[model samples]
Target: MTYPKRFAALPEYAFPRLRSLLDHHDPGGDVVHMTIGEPKHAFPSWVGDVLAENTAGFANYPPNDGSPELLGAISDWIKRRYDVGLDLNQIMALNGTREGLFNAAVALCPEETARGERPVVLIPNPFYQVYAVATATVGAEAVFVPATAETGHLPDFASLPPQILNRAEICYMCSPANPQGAVADRDYWAKLIALAEKYDFRIFADECYSEIYRDTPPPGALEVAQEGGADPERVVLFNSLSKRSNLPGLRSGFVAGGPETIRHIRQLRAYAGAPLPLPLQRVAEKVWADEAHVEENRALYREKYKVADEVFAGIDGYMPPDAGFFLWLPVEDGEAAALKLWTETGVRVLPGAYLSRDTDRGNPGKQYIRVAMVAPKQEMRDGLTRLRDCIYA
Candidate 1:
């Protein structure tokens, strides 16, 4: 049997790689997991009630794009959050942004650029894993750009050579970036939008971690595009209820862009997508409409941010995240630090190298470990303290 060769070069996924690295070793102390980004905070109290009320709807097929009510709710939320008014046609519900992120590439990325070359997809190094996979699945060249400290932890698409830029079809950007937690600002969005416009590529802005910030909401790509008067289809923004409402299992997210962009995405989803169950869609509708729960969730993460700051204080190269929950702590070697921390201190964190690709200079994540601060306050504090003592001491 033969398999597609596109995925041949892909490395093992981050978590499984982590398991292979440490599972056989006996932990020296009580185990405290700070690995995956799953939120442990409470989801909205009303979710159960809403699901119960809508359970009957599950007997019927769900709308592939999204129920009218759910789409309207998402549109209203976008208006409230980004100050950008969107027609319902501009939004398509996603099982999760991960699904939409992958499918959007399949639907939007052209097989060949105007120059008649296999289009390139620009991905930030130390990126969300799905971005590279999506590019590969679509038969595009996946160009990994560095998002290291020198670039302020965001990919500099403008710095690419004109030849590469000319063949670009899609650029994936995660604000409140996954491992590094760096938030892209308004200027960054504007510049990226300008570059996308110049190169005729679409920007896939993964704003999944947008709401888990300290102070001041991060600027959004859609809003920035509107402000700059760029083409409506130039930016496709993906957001979710996972981080916002502490409902990762809800698997509810949405992709918003211009009508044509969404039309293409929704058409693809109609045939090949797994629409959210109607009951879950009802739950998402209610969740998107309510901000009280989201605000409460953000408060919990804010407290965790403070705890992390105090724990890592005075430590050189410890850059406090602009927003989002992960702490990208500097280390001599990520794999070694993670293994040692697990075996010696029983604190499990992800090796940063697992999240990034190697370049000529080096893997940017080689000298770091990603610690997710998603456990209960005391548990998280304990884990961080143990990690600090075991490694930094």
Candidate 2:
């Protein structure tokens, strides 16, 4: 049997690969998972009560787009957070970020660029896997740009050759990046938007971790787009309750952009989108409207940040992340380090190479391991101490 050529270049997903590398061995001690950025913190205490009250709505087919109340909540959140107001037509709730991040490419990426060349999707190395899969689904060329320590762990898309930029149609950017946790600054967003304006491409800004920062709130793409007077359609913003409210299981998120761009996305949502269940939608509305829970969640992450800094202090190459919950710690070889850490200390982590692709310059993630800071404070400290004594010490 033959498969589509598009996915032929794609590698196996990350977690299964990690399992293959570590699961066969007996754990050396009490298992402490420092892999997978699944938030172990508590979610809003009211979420259950809200879900119970809205259970009747579950019987009906949920709104194909977000429910009116949910969209209103999302709009108000955007206005409050990004200072970019949006009409009802400009926003749609997603099952979670993965669906929007993938489907938007299917809806928005052109088959061919204006230059009549195959469309190129610029993806940051060590990216959330959905971006590359989305590019493949669209049959576009996926150009993997390095987001290394040298580049401040953000993709330098502006450095790409004119030819690559000219053929580009979509660029996936994650602020408060997943594994590395590097937040894109306002200046970075402005420059990327300008580059998109000049080259005729769209920016897919995934800000799922926007609320999990240590100090200042990260500047958002839409915020910069509006201030710089870039096209309203230039950036498609994706954020969710997953990290912000510790509601990853809630599977609630939204994509917002220009009305025309959103119309195209909503058209696809009508067909292939998995709209959030209506009860979940009601909960999402309530959660989006409230900031108290999010602030409390950020405080927890800030404590984790302090723990990481204190643990890894004086370790060479241990630059702390600006935001998000993962620590991309430097190692001699990611797989070897991860395996040794697991077998010797029972601290499980993901090898950085699993999250990145090999390029002409070689795999940028080859010498690193991504440790999730999502565990409890004391457990994380224990895990980090074991990992350091095992791998780095």
Off by over 4 Å in 1: none
Q: Show model 2 residue runs off by greater than 4 Å.
A: none
Q: Please report how far candidate 2 places residue 127 from its true position, in Å.
A: 0.6
How would you encode candidate 1's per-residue C-alpha lDDT over 1-393 as one tens digit per residue? Answer: 988999999999999999999999999789999999999999988799999998899789998899999999999999999999999999999998999999999999888888789899999999999999999999999999999999999989899999999999999999989989999999999999999999899999999999999898999999999999999999999999988888999999999999999999988998889999999999999999999988899999999999999998998899999888899999999999999999998999999999999989789999999999999999999999999998889
TM-score for predicted model 1 compared with the true structure: 0.99
How many clashes does each candidate structure show, in the order listed? 0, 0
Check candidate 1 and list the clashing pairs: none
Q: Which candidate is the best by lDDT?
A: 1
Model 1 has a clash total of 0
Each model's Cα RMSD: 0.7, 0.8
Q: Which residue pairs in candidate 2 have backbone atoms (N, alpha carbon, C) closer than 3 angstroms, thus clashing?
A: none
